[model samples]
Each structure stands twice: as C-alpha cells, then as structure tokens.
Target: MRRPIEFKLRRRTLLAASAASAVAVGFARRGVAQEATAAARPAGPETSTVTLTINGRERELTLDNRVTLLDALREHLHLTGTKKGCDHGQCGACTCTVNGERVNSCLSLAVMHDGDEVQTIEGIGSPDAMDPMQEAFVEYDGFQCGYCTPGQINSAKSVLEEINAGIPSHVTDDLTAEIAVTDAEIRERMSGNICRCGAYSNILAAITQVAEERS
Candidate 1:
C-alpha cells in the first residue's frame, strides 16, 4: 500500500514539473516576441526638408526621403515639363541639368540635391521666349510625340557645352586638339536620350543647327 501511495505522489510531482516547464517556455517566447516588435518599431519620422535652386529661383521643399528629384519637380513643385518615362535611369526622359550637368532626375533623390541648382524644361523656356535649343527643336521638327522632347532638349544643350568644354567622348577623334561638334560626337553624347517616335534625324539636325549657330 505504502509503495503504491509513493508512486502516485511521484507521478503528481512529475506532472506539476512538466506544467511548470511549459509555462516557463510560454513566458520566454512571449518576451522574445515583444522584444522583436519593439526593435522593429521606427525610431523617427523619415522625412526631410531641402532647398533647391530651381530655374534660378530658390524653392524650399519638405519631402519624404525616398522621393526622387523627378517626383519633387513634377508632384511637389508642379514642374511637369520633366516627364517620367521609365522612372528608371535607362530612358533618360527625366533628364535635367543639375549644377550645369545633365542627370537622370528619376534616379536622384530630392534630399540629395540640397541647395543644388536644377534646370527643368519650364525653366529653359516658355511659349514666348524659347531657348535656342528649344527653338531649334521646333524649327527642325525634332519631335513627333514630344514625350521625350524635354529631356532631349536638355541633353542636347549639355552636349554642345560638353563638346565646347573639350570633354572627350568615345568618338572624339583628336584628344590634343579642340573637340568639334561632329555628327558622330553629337549622336554618341545624346545616345542616352531616347525618342520613341523615331525622330532621330530631326533631333540630330536640330543639334547640328544649334552647334553651328554657337560656333
């Protein structure tokens, strides 16, 4: 009788120990999950304010960190002249002059160009007073759909500057002498800008006209 009673008491003790172990494990798991949740929480707001000297004017804008320069121009500043073609750097439709250099605006973040100079299509010209490149594009009928015209014009202007500045490209013939604005140089430099309307000839003509006038 005594042995049976002791056996039952030992069984009860084992069962209680098992229950205690399960409770301890559950509490530990809960604590771990809570810690993970806390760690995953954001520490602060992911927004920042930046000032851009756009089109000869200082414009202050507060934008999200992830917002691209293209979006800031189109969405925030309402400068829709810079089109968002591929939203990638491949299309070059969102090309704009940043600090006198043409850059794919879609690939650049707005926060990155704090206090930097930006020139969009609107800044380049208006209906009445058009820049020389804009005039050339219109005169030569350099565009069919005009979707990529803004970027094309922007890039074209920069191409002339690049050549005159003696910036050697792949097709630059003489490295020691002055760089001439040849068809090959213009074509190679403007290769980044794509016109889906197949107006390559017209664009080339427009660029050549501008180059001749400048020379």
Candidate 2:
C-alpha cells in the first residue's frame, strides 16, 4: 500500500510537469506571433511631403512613411482608377507607370517616388476622352467584370512600350535583336497581370491591334 501510494504521487507530479511545459510552450509561441505582428505593422503617423507626376500633372501630398503608392493614389489623392486586387505584388492589379516604367504600386512606398512620374488609369484617360489603349480595350471586349481593367490596361500599355524600346522578355528569341510584338511575347510580358474573368483572347486582340497600329 505504501509503494502504490508513492507511485501515484510520482505519476501526478509527472503529469503536472508536462501540463506546465505545454502551457509555457504555448505562451512562448504566442509571444513570437505577437512580436511578428508588431513587426509587420507600419510604424506611424509621421509624415513627409511627396510630389509625384500623375498622368500628366504633378500632385503634391504629405504622406505617412508607411503609405504605399496605391493607398496614396486611392485614399489620399482620390484617384481610384488603380485597383487594389491582391495588394501584394503577385496580382499586378495595382500596376502603374512610374518614370516611364511599369511597377506594382502596392509594392512601392509613396515616399520612394517623391519626384518620380506616376501615372494611373485616371491620368491616362477619362470617360469622355480615352487613350487609344483604353479605346482598344473597349472595342475588343478586353474586360469582363472590369475590376482588373485598369491594371490590365496599364500593364498592356507598358508591355508595348517596353517592346518598342527593345526590352527583351522571357519569350524573346535573341537578346541582341529587337523584340517583336507577337502573341507569345504579349502573353509572356503580361503574365504578371492576372485576369480572373479570363478575357485573355480579347485582351490579346486588343494588345495586338495596338501594336500593329503603333508599328
């Protein structure tokens, strides 16, 4: 009877220790997660002035250090033409022209482009007077839901411009030779821009038409 009682006491002690260890581990994990969350959070309302050329005009703004170019355009500047699809660089829905080059606005900080030229769809054209690329999109049914239209147009325009500028893409045959505007080339160049509605065929047609007209 004495031996059994001793063993029971030991068992209870072991169980209690295991439970305490588990609790400590859980608390440690939670602490790590909290630290990560805090690290990811943008650090402030501290502001600075930024001047970006949107479309054709230069707009000045005072923005937070953490403010993304996408937020600056949509939330601050009141230019909502640039859609925030994934808000990550993956979707390319926030594609915009920066200094004659295309970039994912969501991936860029507003302060990074203090003196850079930024162009959104709104700056590209308006409802009454649309750019040729915008007109092509309309005529070719390049968009279905239209949520991704602005990004698609911006990316498409950049793809053409890049090709014209002799920039080689993954599909380009020769690095030294001028890049030709082909379906494969367009597809490869615009691969970063995702269209969930799958109007790919129409989009291709529109891009092709623009390439031909410009050539």
Candidate 3:
C-alpha cells in the first residue's frame, strides 16, 4: 500500500508539471501573435484620390494624404524635373508655378490645391522649342550639374513677373511703384534657390541677360 500511494503521488506531480508547461507554451504563442499583429498594422492614414490640372492636362491619382505636391508631381506624374532637394521648404529645387504664383511644391500638399493649375519644369519648354529662360540658361552656361536650373528659371520668371506687377523685394526702398530688376534685387529674390556647384555668377548672368532682353 505504501508503494502504491508513492506511485500515484508521482503520477499526479508529473501530470501537473506537464500541464504547467503546456500553459506556458500557449502563453508564449499568444505573445508572439500579438507582436506580429501590432507590427503589421499600417502607419499613418491610407491613401486618397485627388485630381488636378498639371501643365496643360488634367490628371487623377490616388495617393497618400501625406503625399506632398512635389511627390505627386515627380512620383505619380513622372515629372522628374522638379528635383527634391531638402524635402522641407528650405530648398527651392521643387519650385513650381501654381496659378501663376511661384511656390515650393515640397511644402504644399496635392490635396490642398484640388483644382489649381500646376506648371512644372516640363511645362515650361520642350526640347525642340525652348522657353526664353531655358535658351538663356544654355547660352549663358547658367548650370553646372543642371540640378537646380529648373527651379532657378522658374523662380526667375516669377520674380520678373512680380517686378512687373509692382511687388517690392526685401531690398526695395520704396513700395509705391514697380521695383527695378537690378542684380542685387535678382540675388535677393532668388536667394531661396541654391546651386551647390557655386554657379551663382553664371546664373546671375543668364538671368540678367534674360531680363534685359525682356525689358
């Protein structure tokens, strides 16, 4: 009888130990599943659809709400001329004309301007028939790597228009009349666009030539 009692006690202890191990295994699996589910969850909001006129055509695209106008132009529309230097608004590589006004495409969102007209570098001129600014850039050797030329030309064009519209620059002494497009004014207005290759001399020459031609 003592042997039988000892045997039964050992069997019960073994069963208890097995059950505890099984429970531990189940908990471990549950923890792993929870971790996987958390990781698989999406980040930020889902994409949405937006339509806008680009260049001279209307385009529709479904993009993430967080997508910027620059990304939409370059990634979706395949207008890669708008360079992405400094995704923030600091660099003017993503400069484009929105409704006749120059704006940093990187700073704006595609959804913000639903129906606005966007003019990218591609829209400015074609390879065969170049815009005056494009021709001027080539004639004056305004670019080194040609990375910032698009933004530079776009900004310069807008600056000239602004000067014609009687807008004053930071260096303007009097805001009562149309500001003159002097070399200093050009430098001050085009300060946002940076050419890493130190092509300021050539760029200024190109812009000055264009301005003089237009004047």
Candidate 4:
C-alpha cells in the first residue's frame, strides 16, 4: 500500500522545482514592471537660463532646473573652492552666502536664486588679498585637509555678520542684548560645519582672533 521511495522523491523534487519557477517568474515580472514604470515617468525639464550675481559679477547659464547653487558655482562658473561634502546640506562644506545670508548651497537650486547676490570662496578674497577670515584660518592653522576651509570661512564671515547685525542664535543668552563673540556662540554657529581633521580648537581661535580684531 505504501508508495515507492523513488517515486515519492521524484514528486517532491518536481514540486520544489515548480515552486522555484513560480517565484522566479514573479520576480521577473516585478522587475519588468518597475522598468516599464520608470520608462513611463516624465523626464526632467529642459535647459533654462538663470542669471546670478556671483561674487559681484553678472553671470548667466543655461542649466537644468535641478542644478544646485553649489554646482552652478563649482561647475558652471569654474569656482571650485566650495567643496561639495555630504551633498545633503548636512555638512557645511558647500556653505556660501546668498543675498547676505549663509545658506547650504548644495541644498539650494541655482534657478531659485535668480538675480540673487551669490558669494563663494573665490569672491571672498585671493592669496594676495586674503579675507580676514581666510587669513585668520591660515594664521591659526584652522584646517589640516583644507577641504572644508572655504565653507568654514564663508560661514565664519556670516557668523560675524550675524552677530554684528544682532541676529540671536540658540545659544545667545539675551535675545534683546547685542550678540557677542563668545565660545558658545561660535560653537553653536559653527556646529553645522564638520572638520574631519579635528580642527575645532584652531577654527575657534581663528574666528575669535578675527572677531577680536574687528571688535
């Protein structure tokens, strides 16, 4: 009355193979559907002209609407000082000023800043005419790799400007009092920037020096 072992083994093998085939077919169909859906998606917009006042100069470019301000500066304008780090606006490597406010250029679209005054590291100063912030960084050895220097300097400049303009930060003690260049203030302001080389002390010193000289 019992079935032969060989026959039972054969049946089991066939069932397993059938189940495997079904799974394979399902996966293949899912992959094809995904591909087709991707193919059906709309394409990015055509090129558009964007006018930017970069570093005090009028410049124009025809670029995709998705191009970020960082790319516009580093690629289109050939200003490579603004290092693209993290690319997600987490790292302050692409920090730059737009209309006198410090912004993460990597997160800002070039098209959105049309006719806006954009300032990058190049616009800040040259070796011969180094900006005070740049010089302070060098004098204090604020950077080791120097990849984040441009953004740090830009952000530092903005930090000082914000302090001078009485823009209170989270660490600012008195909202109604004039912002002072305190360690807490600087650290809070510079928290967005990350120096992988562990150059926080030096950067703080540089910013402090510049702030002291200006004050």
| Ranking 1 against 2 by TM-score, winner | 1
Candidates in descending lDDT order? 1, 4, 2, 3
Give residue 81's lDDT in candidate 4 (0 to 100): 92
Candidate 3 residue-wise lDDT, 88-180, digit = tens: 888799999999999999999888888889999999998899999899899988999989889999998998898888888889988886688
Q: Candidate 2: how many backbone clashes?
A: 0
Please write out the lDDT profile of model 2 over residues 8-91, one tens digit for every residue: 999999999999999999999999999999999987689899888888788999988899999999999899989999998998
Q: How big is the positional error of residue 47 in model 3, measured in Å on the Cα after superposition?
A: 1.1
lDDT of 1 by residue, 27-55 (tens): 99999999999999888758999999999
Best by lDDT: 1
Model 1: lDDT equals: 0.95
Between candidates 2 and 4, the lDDT winner: 4
Q: Which stretches of candidate 1 lie over 4 Å from their true place?
A: 1-32, 43-45
Q: Which candidate is the best by TM-score?
A: 1
Could you tell me which residue pairs clash in candidate 1? Answer: none
In Å, residue 97's CA in model 1 sits off its true spot by 0.4
What's the TM-score of each model vs. the native?
0.84, 0.78, 0.84, 0.80
Give a tens-digit lDDT track for model 4, residues 1-215. 36688899999999999999999999999999999999999987877898889889999899998899999898988999999999998989999999999999999899998889998899999999999899999999999999998999999999999999998899998998788899999999999999989899999999999999998
After superposition, the stretches of candidate 3 with alpha carbons farther than 4 Å from their true spots are 2-40, 43-45
Model 3 gets an lDDT of 0.91
What's the lDDT for residue 40 in model 4? 100
By summed lDDT, which 10 consecutive residues of candidate 4 come out lowest?
A: 1-10
Best to worst by TM-score, what's the order? Answer: 1, 3, 4, 2
Give the Cα lDDT of each candidate. Answer: 0.95, 0.92, 0.91, 0.93
